[model samples]
Target: MVPSAIVTLAVLPLTPNGKLDRNALPAPELASTSGYAAPRGQTETILASIFADVLGLDRVGIHDDFFAIGGHSLLATQVVARAQQELNVQLALRALFEASTVAGLAARLNSSTEIKVSPLLPASRQQPLPLSHGQERLWFVEQLGLSNGGYNVSAAVRLTGKLDVDALSAALSEVVRRHESLRTRFAGRGDSAVQLIDPPWPVVLSPEAVATEDAARQRLVALMQQPFDLAQDRLLRVALLQLSPDMHVLALSIHHIVSDGWSMGVLVGEIETLYAAFCAGRPSPLPELPIQYADYAVWQRRWLEETALQRQLEYWTVQLAGAPGSIELATDRPRPAVPSFRGAVHRLTVDQACTA
Candidate 1:
């Protein structure tokens, strides 16, 4: 797919050894304001400010295209989140993607019919909180012993130039402190499962030095492949690998139980913001979250108990009435009752002539 915008740079940034330094390249600038339309009303004004803040621009106009000005799907979620938090309105992520400009999104907000969703507030921890429906299924799979490294979501980012290890550690700890799910552990209360929120604690980074890039890659892969114990171990893992005096790699892994693709984007964004502030000897600028994952878990259980549950079940039941239980496919071996979660990569080369 084509990129949303293309930027022209005078020269490519290069590493000390003269290779392209991808991370050092600048993001595409905000769209030109020659045709800018000033925000007209309160709603549009608020939305414009949110767009600018999320895009890291000084100001955004009502007619400016979000994607044309360096916005992406990950940043779109942040925009929607900020709008919800500021406007106290429920919004679908698709709404922002479809109506990309401030004026268009404000019109959408005006036309929406849904009631304001009750805010997610922190609940008392004295009583055990029930596992979210999604977490319950994962807990079941863990109990069945079918879970493995398959659920681990791992990512690595290369850091160039002087690195601050202490600031990085403090940033990570602050993130864990903000998002309770990263520090949560699950347990069984009779036949039902519950989540326990651990008090925020310091997170220590595992530092290691590697002689070669290949060795660093191997070590990162091994660390990512390590399995997490839902009942015992913390759901997050982070390691810093030093490849050279001027270069390092930060490897991060989180269990799917506590994170997903979207959440990972948010996590990285927070760390980036926090790390910079700490390095500058400034306090964290991130605002405290109104609610934590544990609060969402409690809110979800309460909402599911209402009449909405029956309506949703009936709708889905009708939609899938005639669907088959399983699809039959030829296989080298019979499928086991429990999946081992082992996987392998297979590569196939396609001929250029096939397209022409």
Candidate 2:
């Protein structure tokens, strides 16, 4: 009459940055274990799939917390939209804020379900896909002025421990394959420039073998300094420097037009998941994304052109009317003749009490 199985639970631990620390949790005591647990019922199974698909996860356990594994506000909208479509039940977005797990969501489902939404400007799926409203604003600025070395975003991270180079390469390639915007480039100029989606190729991780850590650091600095030619290659590039067998630095660079601050996190998270899975000789832990950057672009143009232009313009016009065009930063040299996006970054740490 007594249960034989044992279940031990512990409080969740937080990383220095305040996110969940999966590694800090106890290792599964079982012989072998999967991070995901099986779903309990049909509704849980359906909800699991919705969560996995929306979050780019391979699987979801019934009790797994969504935000613990990188879910955010924008992706929450997706989960609500998808659950409405696939489950034939209307669930408020707040249901996620409240429950945030599969079982909780399934229990709270109520209200009449609306049919799936028609494509947001589905007709634009044809050739020469238009850029998103955000992209267009950047593109216009590029066209009018600032012809060179503008709007490039780059970052670097250090990797420790012996790495599997092949696995790392494969993981980077898969991330590029998964995100369409990474392989996309503008093919023409002026009003004619249209997005050209290139077929997936090896997102080259240009490797350099260095004699010492200092040498590797110098090469990394140079690689980050090198400017990108928008027409020459894909919008993203990566480099790996092997300072020694156990230490390396990864340099990842992307153009701002195709990528943004948010997309950066998505890229890094997917790569981490894929790399771990690859090193284990398993298949990628990422799901095929349901919608891509191209779809969002087409949708953005449609909404701005049809539904949002007047409202947005009115709001911004009154908000910024007669505002100063520029604020002068103390510069070391005189400014250039034409407007330029050429820039440098300065980071100053403020005291915690002052910041608060």
- Indicate which candidate wins on lDDT: 1
Please state the error at residue 193 of candidate 1 in Å.
1.6
Candidate 1, run of 10 with poorest lDDT:
111-120
Residue 132, candidate 2: alpha-carbon lDDT? 78
Query: Under the 3 Å rule for N, CA and C atoms, how many clashes does model 2 have?
Result: 0
Candidate 2 segments whose C-alpha is farther than 4 A from its true place: 1-125, 144-150, 189-192, 204-206, 314-334, 339-356
* Alpha-carbon RMSD of each model: 10.9, 12.7
Per-residue lDDT of model 1, residues 273-321, tens digit only: 9999999999999998888777888887776675347757887999999
Choose the strongest candidate by TM-score. 1
**What is each predicted model's overall lDDT from 0 to 1?**
0.85, 0.74
User: lDDT by residue for model 2 over 1-356, one digit each (tens)?
Assistant: 33222447766789999999978876433221236678887878999999888877678887777776657778899998888777755456887988888877776652212222335433445666877767777766666656454576776778899888889899999988887889888765667467788888885565688998778767766665565555566778789987777878888878888887787887888889999999999998678888887887776666566645776689899999999999989998897778656569898999999999
Model 2 residue 143 CA deviation in Å: 3.4
The lDDT, on a scale of 0 to 1, for candidate 1 is 0.85
